[model samples]
Target: VLVCLILRLSGNVGAAPESALITSLPGFSGAFPSKHYSGYVTIDGKPSPKNLFYYFVSSERNPQLDPVVLWLNGGPGCSSFDGFVYEHGPFNFEVGNSTGTLPVLHLNPYSWSKVSSVIYLDSPAGVGFSYSENTSNYVNGDFQTASDTHTFLLKWFELFPEFVANPFYIAGESYAGIYVPTLASDVALGTKTGAKPIINFKGYMVGNGVSDPKFDGNALVPFAHGMALISDSMFEEAEAACNGNYHEPKDQKCSNILDEIDEALSGLNIYDILEPCFYGSAAKDDERKNTSSLPLSFKQLGATDKPFPVRKRIFGRAWPFHAPVRDGIVPSWPELVKRSGLSVPCMDNTLATIWLNNEAVRKAIHASPEAGEWTLCIDIAYTHDAGSMIKYHLNLTAQGYRALIF
Candidate 1:
């Protein structure tokens, strides 16, 4: 029955080609069958283009007419491949001594591949295995990334024409917050086959996204208080001192309030501070010494024996299993701008501009040529609700796209 189900899910039941089950992780158990493909696409009619790496993970059951999800990790330079290995993919890195490759973790039952065939592409060149000999071609910004991704979709469809009609969704967090919407608008507005656009794009899902800078910054104070990182009084004082301006005069009193919050949350592990140094055995020992929940011999912190030191400490105390802050939510805006070709100082201003305009959302949609017909699906309650983030999602609706924030 399991074999039949797997065959039905993959659409490959006869003799069940062994090629599909080419690899499996020892400790990881799940139903995904992993495969990889590499090819080159001409970006500018060049004779030879850089090779692109793509990983396809299919669900265990016989293939259904599942949607295709293209996952892009922000960094403007970071690899979605890493997101695949660490977060939702069929494999995870096991701890090894010094420099050995650890066994792959099997697919997670909750893996998105189970519902949709997920494609993780290393994009824009210079990231992971995707590379270019022409250094000039490697530097890409938002426009270029969007253009390339659009082209990639068309070319990819040409290669696998069968999946061209499948429902497509673009999903990612953080910077992807920007990428998904921008690309969605572009694809929507673009025409394929000279008259119809090739991509069958549906909706997008973004989490903890950085959409509007002003809203995100302003939201910090309330979010801090809600998380108990700061007192309500402190928030009020900071608001008055800064005159509701959080970005100006980095040395202002409002800055101090945020600093205090940062300091208080520092050692508490509220945010994932990417430091060069790792917390060693001594730090782990100290933390465990006062804890009754863990055994004295517990070595969860430094249990890995990989070739290089495992810098990230995966916490086992909670349901989420990992530190929420470390999950790429907090992005270095300056770094993102530098990579995306937008001016660093202008980022905050750009977000601020979006916040000031009542018609900004409508304008942003019209700005894209591909979005011919669009509509607003803004969840006002979700946007204003303390727990939900509406500002982060407004851009999509502004582009005439439908979105449900809650």
Candidate 2:
């Protein structure tokens, strides 16, 4: 009954993918205020194409005039549903009464879609419901990811030509700090090159983004001291021992000091130190002490030997998950999986996992069952080939592209 009402309200919007139009969601019985669509946008078309999944919500206020914003998540392998389900998508989901039941959904008053249409995209093959038949597509890098996303934008516009004239913006956090600027630069370039189905490319915004290695790698030390997580004496000792460079140690003394800092931060949630870092009641003392979450790409913090149980929330302020790399390339999964002695994706995504994997939810969202089970994070052999994002930033900004780095 609700589905019929929603479909009636939406009427015959013919430009967008008709099959992808979602009339009603599983948990929300109320009629949708805005039209929602979810489907796959193929990149590098045909034969062995890379399909990137996207969930698009038209603006609740004004779909035609409002801006179209594309949102991505970091991890190089994390799904953009991280933002949709947890942060700013149109729904606020509550975990089911029991373990296996589906979560209930309520409208999010603060959803970005209230003012502007938002596209939550699962980019780079192998992340979320996005996939490719070619095995080699999964072994991708930053440059290829950006390029593929650009292709996605072009094709997505073709599908929703009504939004082609809407002002478009790219935004994301974490590893997407790398994703946003590179993709923005491509869109800006496309505008000049007479790319068909031209979008009104405007500006981009990144929150707590990882911009440069030198800056990102060196951020946590000062952050820790300012937050009182590290004692004044320890901060001073670290400052003197490492010569203010905690990201890389010059001597064993510096290495020992960084290890001590990791131990000090082991109990607190690195994403948000103010929050309690929960430990399972049965967790052993050594296991509790062994847990430490650090920045994603900046793993100079240290390593841990054991993994402990903790309920991690993705809404934490900082990007926490120490991903160790070698020769500047983020090593393939299972090789450099331990993040600062802690396991990767230290957050608890039980609700998202259950809800997204639900057959009814998948059917409503137009995600194919063949896309397989959905996990918050997947392992992709991601390479940081784009180098420092500074160049991309400079190029885009110089071309009159607006940028906001918060």
Candidate 3:
């Protein structure tokens, strides 16, 4: 979501870290309109370090004055680059003829960076290019993720203090529905508690976010019924069986009805119901084969848990979607995959997987060679400690922090 560019001249106090500056990108030959910087910010140093990676694109309109927005993509385990590559990032990628080739990049006319500088971050250790020397840090939840991201912001500001006074905003889609508001609350608290490099925290935005388990879980039936994806009789039966509480069905009959409804809607694209499902093709076999070492969420979301040629499955089964646990941890991605053994029948991440894994691309972006493979989503033993984000939203909004839900 690219908003209208707002100008606000502010004083810059420190020099931007030169080492983090991106001189060039591998696939795109055109000159960048504004400065770009990327590198790791050590969230926890030494003995067992936790390093978070970020790619910062300065606002083309005014790097010095435009708002700085931190963008996140939610899977509890997903990468923000999902936004950077496919959504509102500055570049639009053209998939190569073969999966092994680097994607061609062109300037995106509707890039959010046109209006504001955007930081595409990989948060929580073990996601995307972010990593931890000690594997134990990989098991984290909402609180630690928010806290680490806040720390990233503080250290990031220290490296590029010029933007410290700029009006700062947080934006994300999907599961970031949880990430944005919670992180906003933390940033607001940081400013009030006299945290260093006081950011001019402004507001936040969430797109198709998940806030409460009860509300989110119950939304599917009505939404499906309204969309005409399910039958009148089926909807009536589900309503009667579940007593309008889809999140927690009282009996096996309701659960069975719900399963029937899922079967009815299974053929449609969960992300975009209008789109036809993509049955696996020979060209995609290579991409599918590359999944063994990749994160389970990507495979599960793509619905590739079992062997190829599986039916297109809905995202409802994936994490962040399974968000209404209210308490306890969502099953790890591999566990979910093992149980379902289904593939995402429509979604294809071939380009992102290929382009990102390229040695040239990694080097160009300042990603460590040792960072291993890149994955859109990773497997994390995440505990839903934040429970319902309703309180966080109410708290932040009450404090005058603007919030947008789309």
Candidate 4:
């Protein structure tokens, strides 16, 4: 019945309120060479817009027609259904700590949906199950999340009008690297399609992106000594005391590189300083039997608490949370802003939740007047190594996009 209520709310859908739940998932039968669907996408007039859950894989026995990607995950309140059930998905979720039946994981031949048609969006407006009976329009930024993802891709290309001129792309990672280049430059500048062209945007991808918070603290002192998580003489004395300054005195070389990366990451264990390198391309006995039959660290991914005292009580009034509150002596920002009367301005809520003062992302797309042409890829070795892993390849070349950086 409605695909058993969308595979039982796609396995226990949390963060509730999809208009008091009713999924309706049926319709995936037969000569199956691809055809999947699950619903919800209702967002008209901002006030109480909810019901935005989606899944629509399609190939219907390929004839070379795919390319649709659109994913977004960054916790400007997280949930791109964990990039479709855990990175490059094709279905994955097997949690049942006290059960007798769990297995349901499928497809993984480098599953970027076997060549694209992904979508997975649970966005701006109280995240998962996407609500918003006006929780103050879910306090969004980045131009109301690129105008509610351009009205959810013009009602998902008016409910799949045979892929309305397919060739779309928009991937994500780390605050979706500022939500896929500000919603792929507002869906490649198309908003009033009365003259046709609502979207065919064929370019965008981001991984480990936080695109220029002034080069994100210029790659945290060489990615804290190439992920050994600090040392190499405290990343060469915080790269010679924040060398050519990074705006604002940044409180003395960010307080001596947060006191020598908190004395070399005290009690060293941010899941052994962020694991996941499952034997870079396998083989030491098949990467120790696939990191001992997976559950690859970061305290098996549940992240065994104490993430720097919960990011020092959630970014204790920034300035990079004053070196984890002066290495845990806590209380500083003008003595916790005169003992929590909370007079805001922690650099205007960290530059308006990282939209970094969005005047359409502070101009400069070569000063857009619909600045047609554009191309730029700043990789600096995955922006100074966090065990470097950035591989991009943009298309549409003849003078619009041609990015590439290994």
* Top candidate when judged by lDDT against the true structure: 3
Candidate 1 lDDT, tens digit per residue, 313-354? 221111011112222222343443345542211111111112
Error of 4 at 331 (Å): 44
Query: Which rank order by lDDT, best down to worst?
Result: 3, 2, 1, 4
Candidate of highest TM-score: 3
Encode model 2's per-residue lDDT on 1-406: one tens digit a residue: 3532443456524589789999988888888889999999877834488889999999999887799999999876788998998888898887565556787888988899999999999987888999888767787777888889999999998898778777899999877888999899888888889887677899999987778766676777888889887899998998899887766678899888888887676545555455444334544443344344444323433333322222334423223222122233233223343543444434556678888998888989989776789987776677777778888898888989899998
Candidate 1 positional error at 166, Å: 0.9
lDDT by residue for model 4 (25-104), tens: 11111233355554556776455664455555554334135777778876355556555544565543332223222223
**Against the hidden reference, what TM-scores do the models get?**
0.61, 0.83, 0.85, 0.30
Q: Is candidate 2 or candidate 4 better by lDDT?
A: 2
Q: How well does candidate 2 score on lDDT at residue 95?
A: 57
What's the TM for model 1? 0.61
Candidate 3, residues 111-185, lDDT tens digits: the string is: 999999999999778889998878788888788889989999999989988887778999997778888887898
**Decoy 2 TM-score against native:** 0.83
Q: How large is the C-alpha RMSD of every model relative to the true structure?
A: 14.8, 7.8, 6.4, 20.9
Cand. 1 Cα-lDDT? 0.47
Superposition error at 41 for model 1 (Å): 4.1
Alpha-carbon shift of residue 213 in model 1 (angstroms) = 1.6
